[model samples]
Target: MSVPVLRGMRWWDIAPVLDLEYELFPEDAWSPGMFWSELAHARGPQATRHYVVAQDPAEGRIVGYAGLAAAGGLGDVQTIAVARDQWGTGLGARLLTDLLQHATAFECDEVLLEVRVDNTRAQKLYERFGFEPIGFRRGYYQPGNIDALVMRLHVHDAQGTGNHG
Candidate 1:
């Protein structure tokens, strides 16, 4: 298999991204309008959002995508998804690393995200990236009534070390 290439997501990538989004999160997939709104803020000098897509070079397909929004010294991970076949391939970590890099570029002091409480795989990935559980949003996910686990990571230490500590 060829290594996937990661690049900034654009308006043209929305169609394939939506397909992967729905495939991965059938119950809570983001609507096209939601993605459009996020993309709208991802450009220009005053942009507050960063979104990226991973493309399979061999097949020219979007295999993963991630987004982040930052403001007021904080960044929030909007979403991250990898195709099932791409799981266990470090695609999730790559996507997350990209987001964190963007958070740092956005001068964020901390980053936050919410994951489905039942999605242990994603939870572990976040933990590996130095995020710590902070709280829970009761019944945060719709349709299924799944709770959400809120997690946070400090982007840097006071001394300017880029360590999550």
Candidate 2:
């Protein structure tokens, strides 16, 4: 199985990323304007965010994407989505790895994220990266009213936190 190419996300990639985003999270997909806002803060000397897209070379399409927001020694995993067809391709881990690496770059002391309570797949992935649940947000997800599990990872404790692909 060939790996998708991972690169810094650019504005042109948002359309394709949004397509995958809606497909993966139909109930709570982020609007284009929300993405635009995030990207607006993702560059230059004042940047505090990192976003990326993974494009399948053979398919020439975005198969996955992830983003990180950092400020005041904290990094938040804003989003992570992988095409349904690419579930077992290690793409999700690859994307998360990118975010964690950036968290370290941003001088973060720790990273945090919210995952749906039912998303054991994602929870396991975070556990593998040394994230521990700290709390929960009731009804954090819209439409379905799903609760969110808040997890945190200390940047210094995550294995290979400084490595990037």
TM-scores for candidates 1 onward, in order: 0.95, 0.95
Candidate 1 lDDT over 70-150, as tens digits, reads 999999999999999999998998899899999999999999999999899999988878889999999989888999999
How accurate locally, in lDDT, is each candidate? Answer: 0.92, 0.92
Model 2 agreement with the true structure over 1-165: per-residue lDDT tens digits: 568999999999989999998999999999999899999999999999999999999878999999999999999999999998899778998999899889989999999999999999999888888889999999999989999999999888776653322
lDDT of 1: 0.92
TM-score of model 1 (CA atoms): 0.95
